[model samples]
Target: MNQQAEEILKFYERQGKPAGQEEILGALQELQQVLGCIPKEVQEETAKRLGVKPSFLSAFIKKYPGFKEVSAVHEIHVCTGPSCGSKDALKILRALEQESAQKERKEGISVKIVKGRCTRRCAKGPNIKVNGELCHHMTPEQAADLIRRL
Candidate 1:
């Protein structure tokens, strides 16, 4: 087993019960939390533990939002809700994308950008999240600045 799989199995072992078939989603989530991206071997082992085929677990990752094939050093999500969209959130997103050097990053900082919906802080329109850190009332310049730092 890989180091990440050992750590993930330890999480389930702590519960004093095997992760049931129904808990595959939970186990997959735990794996993602620990390893950033789920490895093929981890999926195979998880399928074995859940008494399912590896293909089934792959389907879950394909359809699930929390699962990812690749890990990013930083994630930037821009709000595109009614309020944020009205306040030029798209402009900020564009600026951040242009500044991130997404195509080729020799620096190894993989910055992922997403156009997200209401951040719950709708009143704080034009908000963006940098590596899960919420920045409210943002501007293109401010968003660009944050992206550059990544």
Candidate 2:
């Protein structure tokens, strides 16, 4: 097996052969961290090693913003729920889009920005997730700055 897959299996085993999806999610996060993305082969190897059903893993990947099938330099998710909308989440989204576009033109950085569903953290509205890491209480300028830094 490849080193990344080996590391993911080792991490899963270190977590004590956990059967719960939450525990498995932790291992997947580690995989994302080490590999920078969770492609199909890695996902299948993970499922096989960890006794997780492929369908469950597939569903989990789709349901969570943190997991992605395709690789990219960064994936930014802007929360567009009612609470975040009230907090100008759309503005943050636009800022990211514009900044990412500018960077792609100038620096050739690849970024994918998507509108996300309610994260249910309404109190911490206007949240954006960058490469699976959540950032809270964002503004247009801050979001744009984040993209520039990336």
Best by lDDT: 2
Error of 1 at 72 (Å): 5.9
> Model 2, 1-150: lDDT tens per residue?
357758768767666543578777887888777666676667777777777787888788888997776554688888998889999998898889999886664443668998966777789879988898989889999999998898
Error of 2 at 116 (Å): 2.8
| lDDT (C-alpha, whole model) for all candidates | 0.73, 0.78
Clashing pairs in 1: none
TM-score of each: 0.49, 0.52
Which candidate should be chosen as best, given TM-score against the real structure? 2
Q: Which stretches of candidate 2 lie over 4 Å from their true place?
A: 1-72
